[model samples]
Target: MLNHYSLWKYLIVILVFTTGVIYTLPSLYGDNPTIYITQYITEENHQTLDNILLSQIKKILENETITHKSISLQTNKILIQFFCEKDQLKAYQKLLTIFINKYQIFLCTTPAAPYWLSVIKAKPIKLGLDLCGGIYFVIHVNTEVILNKLQEQYIDTVKATLFEKKIPYIKIYKIKNHGIEINFKNSNYRNKSIIPLSKINHGLVIHRIEDNKLHIIFSEIKKHEICERAVQQNSTILYHRIHQLGITEPLVQRHGIDRIIIELPGIQDIKKVKKILSTTASLEFRLVNSAISDFDINNNLIPEDSEIKLTNNGYLVPLYKQIILSGNYIVNSNTSLDEYNRPQVNITLDKIGSTIISNFTKNNIGKTIATLFVEYKDSGKKDSKGHPLLIKHEKIINIATIQSQLGNSFRIVGISNLNEARHLSLLLRMGTLITPVHIEEERIIGPMLGKKNITQGFTACTLGILTSICFMVLWYRYFGLIASIALIANLILMISTMSIIPGMVLTMPSIAGIILTLSVAIDANVLINERIKEELKQGKPVQYAIYTGYRKAFTSIVDANITTIITSIILYLIGTGPIKGFAITTIIGVGTSMFTSIIGTRAVVNLVYGKKNVNKLSI
Candidate 1:
């Protein structure tokens, strides 16, 4: 009983906490300090629009004493950069639209860089793919790769089993058509291998041929494990990559065995995301043996193309191929400017990579490297003279004095702009952007779509409850009215639970979960009402029947609901995304339903039973 009360108290606490949560999220997320808003006006007469927006913003910034700059007009756009607060976001939107009725102005917010900045008039409440658009890539994990891995695992298991019994096998590999290729001299061991392995749930479809090769077809279950492993590996890789990208709450989930879904809300530059995802980030450092001309680098004397492209700076690079030294090798990287005010990136290498780099540099200390090839490309066409030509340019420079205490750490000099330096650092960290992936499926909901979805979802929920309430009153009379009241309280508890729970995500699927809960709440009431009718028909007194009906229903309701809750728990443990959402709501709803139906409805029923006489009861 104490545990039950504590649960109810928890529900109440959640309710109170949720009201505060709803009010606080907008402030925390909306008033982010790093947002910049810029407005583009293609035509005239938008000066008044700009002034009005400035005034509204100025009024809001008064508390912070943040002096509002009058909007600055550039070539095609008027830029406004300020920290936005929650209470002011709605008003800011209204101010921007004040001249929408008159002027032909184009307004848009750039996707914030590195997932922190926003270029909106306000921090957008509903994140859209356009405003926060990034890349969406789905790689079809090859089934053949999974099968091969499984085959290797099976082969290892078999080898261990055979070696224990003093049997020897030449080699093992999975045959393309279907089965295992095992070349063992002993036929007795091969026959024995099949019987024990078959019983081990390996799910191999067995086919024995007269030849040495044993044909095996993997069952759906066995094949599925391969795909599952691939998916898990991909998810892990993506999780690490997203962390490297420094994105908060990025959606990295497996859609199926072979497909993954990634959502970087408020990310701009889909191209950048694609580049980041496709890079393996494999870093290596090789000695620049001798300065080579661009012509030699491009002419296939070098292996594959390198990833690096030399700017004005002289250094050896990967030329868009795999990096010799990746960000992983660098224990740390920082940004600085050179003496000429040009941007430069400093990187500190890890112990191993540093050792390799140090040794390589030490070995080539006195080499006067005149040319360091940064980029090599197949020109593919002849010059104006029409002769077959491959253009190669030498961008590598002579080696400067190498610093000894610096270990493997080095600096890239001569970046033209701060943005360029930043880009270079990112590319270096990402380990060269070669063959970057592109967005396969991009779903962007604009502000208008968000509003529509919100309106529709709310309307659907309201109508569902209203309809349920009407049915309950019409059918069960006074007791039904009591159940209806309980249902409303149940809903409040659901909202409160969702709002206050730390890991809960109130997604579209969660709304359906709530509605499903409402249905279950109604079902419990129906069960109680029917049980009451049964008691009254057996000649029990009105009050006695009412009390007995609830008492009898309580055990059955608890038993049934407990089973449902357990199932939902199992689902939650095994599922992901929307499935988990459904499971979560089901669990919360079932627990809450037991309270409102068993306690809340009973409380109201006791009040009604007290008001009525001894012998008459309305169902």
Candidate 2:
């Protein structure tokens, strides 16, 4: 019942809507390639690194004024764009390395820039470990140890408070299954202690006294809280560590209540990363023995703690602070080569801890302080002294006067390599330099796998579209062939859409989106084909069937696609990354398909059937 003219009209509409081809020429030759580079960073080095990248980009743009340029910056991300010629891709790649290599930048290249335009805005390409192999790590978390540490803090606090209140009780220690046991000499104090102890809630579940001892049981709710805290602590630790390591786009997130995820792209030094992540940089400060001379203090009086044992070099080997400031007061820290070309940590203090630090420095201004012992985690390698050592210690105090002069901020001078200095900064930032904690879990992906996966995925997608078109035309006749053409157009439009959108990444998931769009475009043709068959069966005139079929089917077509549009919107809003790409393409495809099926397809059909007489159903 459909006419040749009407069918031609629908075909054109579909082609225009889906392909953005406008004509056949642009469809094949419009594509071009480009490359991007991401630079590594530390709190201390990001500014210098960013400036270098910006300067290089500015120089390039000065020579060539590329239209449709864009730039954006966030807390830890940067994006830029320009129209690029395919031949210039190699030059761009070299320019990126030359400008950003010193800042530890990683490079990425794409045959097309899809993340700059609005129609099909591509996201920033996420470089997986397989395609851009980087620092791979496996951190085994000591959860039991972390929980015990948490419990210990609460117990210590309660003990200190009871002592201050003169509420004398026998020794208190942690019991099995996460409870505290107190040996009280007086029954009266034991009953009174329960009410006072109820206030000590550091994520602990306090149970009533059982079997002549106080039983503490951490319920599921409490356990979950503890796990969450551990994850937060782990995330913070990894963030600080990666920040210090100067890895850009470091993915650090909570995996489960008990685990964490950290991905540092482009970090190839496994040993260095392992060493930095493994070391617990515990920093402590203790008052000097004013009674002894600097020489005597250095020569004798060993620290009791095994982690801070003294050495035999006529100077105290290692000593920890008895009671000094914690590293949490350090809001920011960075590493730099000193005047002597040795690595040093330059730290900045937050306001809450500044008062204490300012007062400490003011009081110790002119004093020739004795050995301020420093400890370093041995890299598990042999030292020059040929000892099977676990840790290293230094008792030098050349910087005590320097520390006193810096007010709230201070510097730790004298370290071997840039890696060591960075490690020191990570330790301080992770809060392990002030406390004790260990890595819980880790995973790493390399660039090779990413490239393989992406290539295979794209190949499969192309094959799928070709096969789909072959089947559609073979099964549905002339109308099916028209639909297939439109579907191809739809794909071009989607690609071009992405090229125009900023921050859009043409990832593996986005290929899936293109397939979804193809389905939607074909579905519109199916609707029209079915409508034409119904009119033909009803014995309507060819021209009447053609007009009526499209007019009557128009409402259903619009309604169906509109409902799908709403769903796609919701999906786009809630989904992350890949899912969002699918939703965007699907929604756009549906809208475009509807117009082409109703209008363009009708025109083509009318043109074909306008003067024909004895019509046999072909579409």
Candidate 3:
């Protein structure tokens, strides 16, 4: 009878201990300092690090007398391992001197476990930014830029529609926030333009004025939609940029209609991140206009149906007004090398963009195509001498004629170096930022501080558990020892369950959840022991008291835990970030407590006190 275990009880214990261990093993293996390299290598490069780049890295390491462990390129990341954090930093510095920003490098603390462990799909818990040493940024979006861009697009659409319908409009002028106004020579032309303009889908109000003019303005509803869409697009763009950096579990979220929040774990250098956050990069494919008359590149002259674009070199090149394609159509872009081993960006288009490119290229096989690189930076951020750290407007990076008709995919070569290729491809692949964003707030937490927080938190948790164990054992003697054992088991079960939860991040608040659950576990044990003492005082035998005590305590345990479970679920549903972490830990801990308090303690009590001849009650 003492060894009795229903099939369910046997299954529960096995499941808890076995799973708890498998998920917890990775954390115990410890961490090594590794360098994460985001090279942005595209498939078009048709190259791998092991081919050319790896050899160069190895040569540098060997010359510098630096030791390394396993080196690999996975998930578009170059992970170079080292035995000590000191060596990792040393190697990182040495390599930076040679490469000079060829890649985005992160000196990260990576899992020191063997390849076999990773092959089996075991990973350590993801810690929050505060617990792992990282940077936090609160950025505010420029919604006015989004509105003006939309209005410019609408103006183009209205012009094209009037031209297609053969409606004679003398001129079209933009009226800022009021939208585009068109002047017609006569009332007949203005009335005719109205029917064609009615085809606009994005909620525009068109009116005819006494001056034989037509005005189109965005409706209130459309303006709100544009604002919402701009914020969403900026969030999405920022997400891609973060992912491209190869940072794990970095948080990119919308804070308000015009604000965004970014949390990057293990990033110490704030200066390296500020430029990427503030600058907006995009791409344009326009036809080269070589027939234009040669003019002074810096005269600030304006030409008809053409624009002067400053190339990466000092010369300004003329380009047609019509853009053949834009970065918005690109679904993916990556770094690669050309036939000459020169760095290049390979771009892949979405279905619609592919069709547009296929039709255009098919018609103009010998035409020259120019790839214009555009970057918008904040003018307010300056260097020491009051000069802008970056050019505040668009610059054309490269231009080449089409060799043959092509579609779907193409490579942009002539990048100055590998770093340029990586950066250009990264920006192209990430699409465009709908508007500029300003960093409203920024914070950096060092790794030493994060480690200290972890230490103090765990020390507090351990001291609390140890103190509880001593109290339970001292007060109730033998039965209290059994409760202490169950309390240890409760801790183990709670940790194991949390380890297996997908996307569960451990924060300081999560530790609080576990501490609260430990108290609940102790309360459950107290309820059970007191019920047994009451049964014995009523003159019940030892075995009968055990049975009645468990039967009486089961209802209270379920009722107490279930109410807390419901509240935790509600908190998890409404909460975000750290609050969700706390809610999750609480939910898992409550279930583990129920198992350890009622079933685990009872099993030990049965083994020790199952004899029928027992007369004296320990409690």
Candidate 4:
């Protein structure tokens, strides 16, 4: 009984090892090359893929003699799984060429794990960008646009304040470089307006420009604060959007004063990813200017406070400049079908937006309202400082008459297709970018390089493990073999834990951590074996020596592992990117190694040499 384990202890060890193997089995299976097809939403056209489109794709593949595993329809998209990467690439090229304007295509990979394993949600450990290959982007946020917007907002504020204080002005407009200029009828009115404007202390610098004008500009400190805030806000928004895409371990961080660096590991949809990241789209609800007839619009009689925008059907409609609601107030949005089975976006607004919409709808019972869709896009032209210029696009997506008082929840019709509706809903729900961003640099890491890195990492891990096994066996014989087995179990348990945990990514540094863990496990076994040898040399009996060796070695093993676990914790807390990846594996590996090296090896040793008749030990 000295070295024997109880029934419950044996069962616990068996259960843990079996569970580790079961979870590790999923990683042995490979991934299938696949193609994902969705509607390419554009300003002029949006169309979802249907059964007809699926048939067309199938026909095209058959005609080209491209072998495909299966073709199926998914939510808002179509998926085609192929047996190999060659066929996947060929099919992607063929489909893209034929449906260039109608659909967006992406080359991707999905798990080929069996149905049973998938049912249990078993998955392989995620690979990092360096190992799995993905798209890397360097984005430049346009801080100047934010400044311009702030200045425009301040212009309204100044106008309201001066008017309320009974100050007269001839005209107020933005200056050529920065800030705003207000021209007064005379010097006295401008001087009188200065005091009221000074009360709005939002970092505004009010200067008397000549006798009858005042020039207002943001102070240097205020401009810097605005730029920093915009960059930080954009970074946060990008993080949310990337996570919504279901990408794990994406890197979204600020690089320079106005630039963001993003690394999306294992992502292959370049076009869709770019659209989601760079497109600054928002919605504005404005009341329709019903007084402006079409005849007057055609003759260029648009009002000063109203602008004419074209609808989706190519008809021009006049809408008031005042916005009743903006996308910023939207808390949630989803895609749904309307009464006529047309695609629509269901929206839920915050309290303030709800109040604004309710008040407006209550006052104008029969008045018409227009939904203005706005986007800022790169114009492919750079400014003097080499930054891309942005073009603001606005269109009336929908115009509807008020049937009743509206509140927090409503649906907008006139979306071209389901895909478009989904895209709009995703953007609105994730929130819009504060300013337009352009891709300053982009790099695509091919799967070939990724495969090479993975191969190298696998080779390194296997070599390290083999070396550790051979050394342990040659030194301690039978006891060394038990330690080797425990070492292997430690590796399995570590990998399984990584797979089970969310957001654990395997990188080159993680591989190094695994190798180090194997050494640590071997060290623990060596300490126990040496202790047994020492006890036997001191003339202790065989069973007593074995029990005493394990008992004496437990404290040293725990102390060393505890120190390592603490160090790993500190690394994880202070590190970023690759360092974090390494730290995560080290932490998990150290924990598993402690269990295998002490508890697991002991279980096996007790079964092998825990008898009263034993007189000598192999180790």
Candidate 5:
């Protein structure tokens, strides 16, 4: 009766073990090599593939004699399963040539788990880049561009303040990397402008260059703050974009002053990745220069204050240089159809942007405003510093009259098709980069290396677990066998818990954590076994020794595991990349080990020896 457990306790242990085993089933099924083909929208053409396109792809594969396991169609995408990676690669190259500019084709692996397992939301543990093999990118942010933009804004502020305060100045212009310079007629006007200009921005350091000139520059602290903010903003936007792509466990983090390191595990679409990461797409709203008539446009005559921008239809239109609003303040966006059944992007702005747009539209009703779509592209040229040169591309996406005083929301029409509309909406919703970024370094880890890593990790784990089991059994006899069983259960429970937890990626170091956990679990059982031996040496009955041994071991086990959990948590909080992955597995492993080493082994021991009236123990 002393070593016996209640019916409810046995049921709970059984239920937990059963659940662990069930969830762990999905990982054993592995993954299948597959190719995914999705829609790729361009400015010239924006169309989604249909079943007809799927049929054509299937026929092309057949003509090429490429063996495929199955071909299926999903929403706006097609999937082709293959028997092996060779077939998958072959079919990918074949389809990519035919659909080069139209469709996005990429090779990836899909879960081969049973339908029933997936229906219950059971999934395998996510693997890190080192384990799964993918792309690594070291990107450099152009902080100089951000500083220059800040200088321009400060220039605008100085001009606005000078005009408002009735201060006279000859001219105000930016002095490249230094700051803004204000030329005045005399020292009287220059001295008068200093007070108001100094109050414009907290970081501005205003100084008089001469009797008729003043210079304004940002302080060192302010410049550092601006650069840090821009780098952090770029990192956040990149994270959002990668998440929208449905990538799991992507590593996007700042490396140094102006660099970001990104690890995309199991993703093979290099072109798409570069396009999404490097693109700084945004929108600007400006009033169209209606003063220039169609006749002036035909003669290519443009006003000094306006610039000619080509529309998506290849027509040139003049727009004012003043921007009323920018996409930086856009909070949300979605693709929708207008009243005329044409594609449009419905945008919702933040409070500041909403107020700006409302006041502007209220005062300038009936004025034509143009939506400018802007993007920064790599020019295939490098500067003196060996950095890639970025060319700015601007197009007039829409030009329409202000019909009403739009508040927080508005719609832009003239999108070429639904696909383009959707693409634009996605970019706006995910937020735009604060500055341009170029790939400073790129490395592609092939699937073969990943496979080798997996094999080595598996071998290490199997050997560690088997060695632990043998040691435990040789030391404690039948009780050691019970401890060994509990040890194995700890592993299953750990893996299942990792699978259930979102964004938990398994790396090589994670396997090391698993092995370490097994040793700790064995140590716990050894404590119990030693305690029982001590109790038996004191002339105690077998049942009394068993119950007292477990009762005394509980304190030591909890204390040890609690300390380990705390250490793992600290590592998790301070670590990055693979260190975090290792910490995560250790925390999970310690938790599962606590449950299995104590509660799990106790249940098995009770069933084996609890009710028996024995004069001697197996030990």
Candidate 6:
């Protein structure tokens, strides 16, 4: 008589499949419509919005009779989650118009996992951007501009040190060799000033040259530091800016020394993206003077300390070099319609800027103040000599006369449209970029295409599994039917195992991995069956062949799966995005297949064939 599995072995199998069933519960519940209300919520708004939004949502739900699974008021966000897509869409369409400048509403999809399951930290596999709709951008920052700006800032420091130390110099200017050249009255003045310059930090090197000139240069180490810092700070700015645009979990990564890679999942609006990402905004408030003598428009400018700026209205205004206030002092910005029904930007300054602006306007009541707009873009124009330049082009976006003394709050009138007003407001809130950037690569993935891909991938997986099941049953007969049952068990265990793993993404390539796993699952079954046939042909008893077959096949199965597992580990470590997805699923599926193909199929064999004393074998 054949031996049945021991109680402990039966208990182990039961425990594993039970755990698999529990984990599989999450995948059974499909995705639901999700609404996210993300905004830069201040403490005052946080307390006020709780009750206001709750009441508003109540009224909206009462009118529409739409019920939501949960309404979570998180920090900096409000999430209205529902199991039904129609209800989610209806609430989104109704509530989005109300937030306005207060918040941004985005429609998304999330699994309708139960509260208890979520409490246990269980979640279904996340879909990748390649499988979900999204946009990709490769942005290249102009490190030259960053370096040039840093040099100019340091030049001011150098000038200050000379004045503070009372070192006499004739003239100082930036040189083409990434250094500043300072000319003294004589070599004695330059040599005497060298001691003071030696006290300077900020990675500046001062060297004396011929003709009473001293050169201040940045070392190679400092240049490398500048490049690294430029990328890091810009990445932080882009992350903040994207979140402000209502995107969750966006990937803003550093590619090279001056390049950045950005991925926004579930975003399809290219225009909105351009407005948020492409605009390089900087604000400057300067006094426009009546010093026409200061400007020789034919010669490009008039004074060293002042420059002639052309306004949008075709008027040339000479602005002082000193900026009274910049975007750094801004506290908030909002878009609204003016008394003339034209789009306008209402800006609020910080406490310091408020005091400064109030005093400046009071002293220059009849004077004209200009708001200089600095933008970074490739204007698609060549230089006079046919060379191209991507630079920060500064012009006067708005120029208004000071009728009376104004305070921290002011309006920017004459915006072309409401869209312009909104875009400007967003830029001001996000702050200005340290340097200009260009979008070197752009791609858009529509939601429709994403859905099509999902359908095709899922259909292909289903067809593949069915074909394998049919072939297994036809060739192996009773044993094949048993193998097919284990195949089903293998799939359930694979999905459940994958779902439990943290941060696993189910992508298109991952489907291929799944199908490949199923094929590999049959290989194990084939090994066990062929070994059993060989033992039976050698005149061994059915019971001995059954036991011996498994003993011999186990080694081969271990060796084959071990190699595959190692390859998958390598792939996961080195791959990106979809490739990582494939590797993760493959690794998990291989482990699950090993168990189901050996232990699971053998348990069935023991329960059916092991309990009898028949000499005939099914295979």
Estimate the TM-score of every prediction.
Answer: 0.52, 0.58, 0.80, 0.81, 0.86, 0.65
Cα lDDT tens digits, model 5, 564-618, are 9999999999997778888989999999998998899989989988889867765
lDDT of 6 by residue, 1-619 (tens): 4446887887898899888877777777866767777643211121223757876777887788889887877754677788776897788778856664555567776677786878876676666677777888988876778788777766766777888888888888999757899999998888888877877765778888996999998888988898888778777777777876556657787887788988876766555565567667788898886665533666675654567887767677788766778886776898888878998999999899899999988998888888998776666875573433676667787878899988889998876677666766767888667677777789987767877888898788788788888987888778888888888888889888888776566778898899888878889999998998899999998888988988899999999999999999999888876787789889888999999899988888888877678689778
Residue-pair clash count for candidate 5: 0
Model 2: per-residue Cα lDDT over 453-561, one tens digit each = 7678668768877887887788788877777766765666665555444434455666676666666667777777778778888998666766677777778888888
lDDT of each: 0.56, 0.56, 0.77, 0.85, 0.85, 0.78
Candidate 1 stretches greater than 4 Å from native: 1-249, 256-259, 264-284, 290-324, 329-332, 338-342, 348-402, 405-411, 414-419, 426-435, 474-482, 499-509, 529-551, 562-584, 599-619
In order, what is each prediction's RMSD in angstroms? 12.8, 9.7, 5.1, 4.8, 3.9, 8.9
Higher-scoring candidate on lDDT, 5 or 6? 5
- Tens-digit per-residue lDDT, 67-167, candidate 3: 99867767766788899878889999987776654555667777776677688776777677767788999888877666776776677778778878888
For 511-604, candidate 1 gives per-residue lDDT tens digits of: 7788888887888899899998998899987777777787788888989898999999999989987789889988988977887887777655
**Candidate 3 clashes between residue pairs 3 or more apart in a chain or in different chains:** 42-335, 45-336
Model 2 alpha-carbon drift over 4 Å, by segment: 1-124, 127-138, 207-220, 236-253, 262-269, 272-279, 282-329, 335-344, 349-423, 426-452, 471-482, 489-521, 532-619
**Model 6: residues >4 Å from true position, as ranges?**
1-16, 40-48, 64-72, 82-91, 96-102, 141-146, 152-172, 175-226, 232-249, 268-444, 500-503, 565-576, 599-616
TM-score leader: 5
Candidate 4 lDDT, 1-619, residue by residue in tens = 7999998998999999999998988888877788877654332345656898889889999999999988998766788889998999899889889877776677777677787998888887777777878899999999988898777778777877887998989988899656899999999999999889999876889999889999999899988898999899889888877655444467787886999989887677777788768869989999999999989899999865578998888998998777778887888898888889998999999999999999889999998999999999778888999988889998888899998999999999988887778778867866778888888899888778889989998898899889999998999999999999999999999989998997677888998888888777789999999999999999999999989999999999999989998998899888876788888888898889989988999999888877658987777
Q: Judged by TM-score relative to the true structure, which candidate is superior, 2 or 6?
A: 6
What lDDT score is found at residue 521 in candidate 1? 81
How do these models rank on TM-score, best leading?
Answer: 5, 4, 3, 6, 2, 1
How many residue pairs clash per model? 20, 75, 2, 0, 0, 0
lDDT measured at residue 454 in model 2 versus the true structure, 0 to 100? 64
Error of 1 at 366 (Å): 9.5
